[model samples]
Target chain A: MIDTLIWLVALPLASALATQLLPRYATAIVISTAIATSINAAALLYAVATHGVMLYQIGGWTAGLGIALRADGLSALLLMMAAIVLLASSIYASAYFNDNPLRRRFWPLWLLLWCSLNALLLSGDLFNLYVTLELLGLSAVALASLGGKTAALQAALRYLLVGLLGSMLFLAGVTLIYAGYGTLDLATLSRVVAAGPIAWSALALMTVGLLLKTALFPLHFWLPPAHGSAPAPVSAVLSALVVKATFYLVMRLWLDIFSEVVTPQAASIPGVLGAAAVLWGSWQALRAERLKLLAAYSTVAQLGYLFLFFPLLQALPAGAARDAAMGGLVILALTHGLAKSGLFLAIGIIQQRSGHDTIRDLDGTAQRLPATTFAIALSGIALIGLPPSGAFLGKWHLLAAAFSAGQWLWVVVIMIGTLLAAAYTFRVLGHAFGQQPYPRHPVTIAAEEWPALILSAFATIGLGLAGAPVWQLLKVSL
Target chain B: MLTAHWLYGLSGCLIMTFGLRAVLLNDSLLQRIIALNVMGTGVFMILITIAYRGPDAAPDPIPHALVLTGIVVAVSATALALTLIRRLTEEQDND
Candidate 1:
């Protein structure tokens, strides 16, 4: 058990370091490590599934002095989602960047980013999470600029500055928490935390910092540019994995550690911002000229669904309803992770074929590659929360919880968001099929397309068909 | 004696505000990076203040350790940001 926990993080770090030292075998090392890490992640998920929450104290020092790694049901689910998305991304990238000179440099940083993500998800300490966040931020920024275009470099710069600012605010909040409670461990802090000025200030600072990092709504200005300009694999990881990590931390802080410190008014703030994000983000997405920009805006819109659960959760009393709402939020996150990564990967193929991602120009290219179009169509269905998709199931619970709690305003918001999502998604797909029938020969990039197809299938049919296991996992705890 | 903690805390907050304002208001990328580092320094200062105990008691090592890690992170981020900024400038120059 402990070995799985250790290797889940260690394998990536080892491969990252090894890649830096022996640059020739970077691809071989990264691919093998990605496969190994995903296996370990699966093992960790299985362990958490059967045994419940697993905690490992480092160096035999429990609680106060030593760091702790924990794998609750939520962490396990996130680990699995990350593993699948990253493995697919690695495979797609191997083919996508087969001849690019920057391919070797990409491997090591990507591994480091993966390592930090696993560490952040498993971390039980607040300070340790801060370290992991910084590590993730740096590597992600480096990868974002790997394309080295003026636009990519500029976007990476902006992302870096904002990310550092966010980390600083988070650290300041941690300082206050330590001042008020004298502990930096999340589990310990949760026990001792209470509603007071210090706690409120600390929570507010941390939440705002996380919101900025998550790029929720008004703070999302930096995301579209960065995600749109990066090489597609980097964009996929950033959109699907990086932002979600911060959001996960915010959810963890609110729902688990700082639940005592939460107030109705404070919770509504995010709910309000989430609604705006849904509306504005979807509108922008509908008007986006470039397919990559559309995907980025869709990410902004999709993240709003996660936050919309907050108000409903706060309004519902402790029972099946609140649990379902929380479960819905997790399902939404997982689905978005899978679906978004697949969408970006498909877009990468389209861009490579067409030499650009403008939705208008992609018509001829898309007509040529049916597999990529199908990947987009499949993921787009999930993204739009159409019937029989995991997002549909998630939104069903969200709407149920909202209606039961008498929160009809949120229902209207979700409906509007869904309509906008459908419009924008099909707008791109509408361009894919031209009046002229292009020859339907097998795509040369079939290897790259398969992972995306597999991922979209999981996002749509796989999760949609299998709800009992996910519901069972969400039942473990907050 | 009572006012010392509040004094330190308020000053830390003020410095943070200044840094944040500078980061948001500055047009120059270099100034924003500088502002970010300053903000990090303010946070580190707050952390150090939080670690302070009574004159006789041993200060908590945890916050100190946290501050050290924060410093390392801050330095690495600064270096990366500066490098990106340099690369952008060079790309523009070549153009």
Candidate 2:
């Protein structure tokens, strides 16, 4: 089972290396790797489900001496989400970049990015996480620059600088932890950690570093341009997987490793920024002119919702209520990962057809591509937290938790964000339904269209309707 | 010995603060990239300092290994950032 974890990371890495040697077969190699890893992810999920939390110590070494790979319920769920989203993105990229010159470069870098993501998700060691983060950051920047346009290059550079800075700060925090505790393993740290200046300082550094990487609220200035200007598939992964990875780290550090050091006052800081992000990001999304920019801003708002879980967790005593809030957060994250990637892919198709992604100008193209438009609508429903979508249920539980805890301020924030999301989502839909005099040219829907449609449908109808299993998955005792 | 550790830690923090300030304040891409590397090096020095002990004691190998890995990652990032910067300059020149 643990050997599969090694292969899950190594397969894509080896394929990435192979793609460089045989660029002609790079597409085939990448697609096969994606499929293979999806199976591997499923197998890992099943193994964890049946066997409970499994920790694979690298090289058969014991604690405090060597690294380990941990797969708990949360890690397994995230791995499966990543596998699904990346598989869909990979399939879409094959058709989306069919005739493009940059496809060769994209396949290799994307595989490397995928490899880093799996490695990051599985890594239980702090230093290993840092290494994987560096790998993920570099590959992500490289993929963003595959567009070869000035805007793309500029966005990539800015992203690289921000990411490097975040990594350095995070490493500094890790240094402080190691200096104080003499261990880099999270499990060991959690057991040994105590409330102290060193621990508090380390938590602050790591939290801020991760917030920057996650692009939560004020640090999110770099996200829109980077996500909006990248190629469609790159944008999908950036919004769906890469940003979420950092947030996942923040949660791990706060709730698990640094739980001993984290005070309620300190926890409320993210909660406050989260509220700000909800209002500010939604306003930005509502005002965005470009379709992709709107989606990018929506990501910021959705990430804000993820942070809202923190205060609820802090407020509620450790029991069913806290677990329910955590489950809601997970559900929202998983749903958003699916829906946002679908939204981006749909926008990509729209851009290809219309030759631009200016939301108001997409009337004719949107009319021509019904499947893609429907994809957007379905994802839009999920994003807006409408009935029968995963986000709807997730936010319901979150709001319930918030209300019960007497945190009415968060209730108001959620209400405002939902309305704003609806406004922005429908803004594109309104434009899509416009009447145009130009004769309808039949648009050939490519193979790429299906992945977005399927994923969005799963998010909207599937997860919304049958979220019990997800809640069940989350119920596995820690 | 305790004074030496404090001095090294304090200096590391100062170097990091300076590097971070430089990175944030600079408008030039090269300066920002260089500043980021400087910031990373400061962190590495701190890790090394933490690993240091008395003259007779063997230094902890963990931070040494970590610093080595950090250097590789930092170098790769710097190289990639430089390449991107060069491309940006070329595109601007063409424009």
Candidate 3:
């Protein structure tokens, strides 16, 4: 049972390799990886349902020596999210990349991305995470460059440079941890990490690196361009998944490694950063002229919601804090994953048809692409924290926790973000609602619109299905 | 031991400051990349320094491991960025 953890990594990786071998039959690879991982996801779900948590020690070694990979309440929930999103994205990617002549070579890299994402989410060791992060970054950059336009290459290059710097910093921190503790296993590192200047310094270096990689606020100068310029599927992956992987590492380290040092001082910094990001990102999003860039900036604002957990947790009791903070973030990630992907997918269709994503130009486009319009509406509702949506549930608990903690500043930021989300969401929705008078050109809907609609449906309705299980999963008794 | 740690820390701070200045003042994107790489190297040095226990004691190999990986990743980035910059300039020139 324990050895089965490797399947989380092994299957997608094998498919990635297979895609390289049989590049022509790309859909086969996509279908197989999705199917294989879907089965694994079901198995994991069943295991978690019957048993509590699952642990796999690498190479049959014990926890302290080789490495221990454990799926607790938090890990299992995220794994489920990753599996669903991966399956949906692959389905969408099949249609998205099919007609693009430039990206005929795209499927292998996309599968590679799926492999790395799945592997990154599941890997039990720092070294393995490092390996998977590289794979994710490289594949993402290549995909970013797939647009074959000047701006796309520029964005990919910028992304490439930043990614290298980030990885270096991450590796350096990993080194410091390895030296200080003599083990890279997270569980082991947590128990052995003692309070000292060295430990604190390592934590600081590690965080600076991750914060940059995650594109959190001031360090986010690279994100808008990279996300803005990439083709839609690529943008979806970059915005929805890749950013979170780096942040996921930060969460893992903070939760397991520096759980002790989450003192009063450190609490307010991430909180302040989160609050600032929410306000600043919303303003930026509202200001942007292009739809893709607007959506890109929206990601910056959405990420701010996740960072709220840091301070909210600090202000509450242990068991309750984990309940609110972790649960909020996980649900936030899951919901935003579906919504943002759907939004990007729909925008991709709109762009393909209209041949532009510039907001000012979209006078009327509703009648022809009603499904796309509906998709945008659904995604917007989810993004805006409306009821029966995951974002709302996440936001509800987060706001409740904020009030409980008396973090009025965060509560205000949350409200402002919701308003901004509604504003921009409506702006797009409004365009799709009106009729497009035939003037310059007629738009064409591809075989692509339905996938976008399906994703949005999942995001909107899937939240309702997930509600009970999610509540129980949040019951992390520490 | 602490003195050596300070040495690495000072170097890292200097590089970071230089990077800030370079990013601020330099119009050349290439120079900015150069500065970024320099700053990254300095950070790598700092991590290795943190791994240092003493002149005689077992030097922490974790930072060494990190440096090894970081160097490879940095080189790949520099190469890729250079290619993109070249292509960008080409497109601009064509325009």
Q: Summing lDDT over every window of 10 consecutive residues in candidate 1 chain A, give the lowest-scoring window.
A: A435-444
**Chain A TM-score, each candidate:** 0.98, 0.97, 0.94
The DockQ figures for the candidates are 0.88, 0.92, 0.44
State which candidate has the highest DockQ.
2
Q: In model 3, which regions exceed 4 Å deviation?
A: A61-68, A436-447, A475-478, B1-27, B31-68
Badly placed stretches (over 4 Å) of model 2 are A436-443
Give per-residue CA lDDT, model 3, range A1-478, as digits (tens): 6555678777777877777787777687777778788778767766766677777877788865565667655566666666776677677678777767654567778878877876776666776677677878888888888856787777787787677667656765665676567777776677778878757877877787788889888888889999998888888878888898788878877765687866767877877888888888888888888888988888898888888888887778867555766677778877888888888888888787789988877766666667777788898888888988888888988988988888788888999999998898888766666644543322344346766777777777788457667757656311
lDDT of 1: 0.88
Model 2 lDDT, residue A74, Cα: 81
lDDT of 3 by residue, B1-93 (tens): 489888876787677557656755777889978976886677677667777888889986756766787677667767777878888899878
**Candidate 2 per-residue lDDT over residues A109-164, each given as its tens digit:** 99999999999988888988889989999999999888667888998899999999
For candidate 2 chain B, the 10 contiguous residues with the lowest summed lDDT are B1-10
* TM of each candidate vs. truth: 0.98, 0.97, 0.89
